[model samples]
Target: MPDDSAPRPSEEAVEEAILTVASLPGAAKTVTPEDVARSVAAGPDWQSLLPSVRRGALRLAQAGRLVLYRKGKPVDPSDLRGVYRLGLPPEG
Candidate 1:
């Protein structure tokens, strides 16, 4: 059984993960909790994120940082879904 006593992953981590995934073509389509977990596994200070951060990440994505998409449809920031797209090539 899972340890209920253990602290749950922070929303910030999840949101950051979401953004990271959003940056990627496959993950941007469907953001899920599991995908976020995979992001944590990759490498992040997951222990320090807060729920607000998660919410903030979503807000950022919606605003135009991460970029959201669905059903092969591109997310236009001005839409009701507040969906966006990571259009530009990632900078090194």
Candidate 2:
């Protein structure tokens, strides 16, 4: 049985959403924060998942598994604001 009482996002859920969406269509594709929020959210109140998504993104960025971008440029996860996108790091 699942704990339906707790509707909040979990770190594992958020991380999975980020990685899953980011890798869905190769490294060139990017997903918005809202995209991840929607993926982990259990209900229509996905807006509430933004904070958790951002936090997960920061952690993934630090671990080098993801990259956060704003205005087409990579931005420090700590400095992200306004609109942002997530994607796998560029291949070398």
Candidate 3:
């Protein structure tokens, strides 16, 4: 089981991991939920944090620092479901 009193990963940490991974050269600068989750997980429990990664992705996307993609097209973060990828928005 999990410890309810245990401190969870910070929202900032999650967002940072998303940005960091997506900013990498490969994968077209995009990342999956599991990517960020594993980066933020304390050990090997990354699977449990998938939802948190998604939520952080939404927050960062809303803040305009990140972009959420579905089916290779940029998407509105608020209406995400199924599978999605995250990346830094194109610089202009």
- Go through the candidates in order and give each one's C-alpha lDDT: 0.49, 0.84, 0.83
Error of 1 at 45 (Å): 18
* Better candidate number, 2 or 3, judged by TM-score: 3
In terms of TM-score, which candidate is stronger, 1 or 3?
Answer: 3
lDDT of 1 by residue, 1-92 (tens): 33445566665656666666655765444554344554564344433343343454457657666544544455554452433233322456
lDDT per residue (tens digit) for residues 1-92 in model 3: 65556578887788788888888776666778887787777666788888788888888889999999999999998888889988888999
Query: Which pairs in model 3 have colliding backbones?
Result: none
TM-score of 2: 0.82
Error of 1 at 9 (Å): 2.5
For every candidate structure, what is the RMSD over all alpha carbons to the true structure, in angstroms?
6.9, 3.6, 2.2
In angstroms, give how far residue 13 of model 1 lies from its true place.
2.0
lDDT of 1 at 8: 60
Off by over 4 Å in 3: 1-7
lDDT of 1 at 91: 52
Stretches > 4 Å off in candidate 2: 1-6, 26-28
Global Cα lDDT for candidate 2: 0.84
Check candidate 2 and list the clashing pairs: none
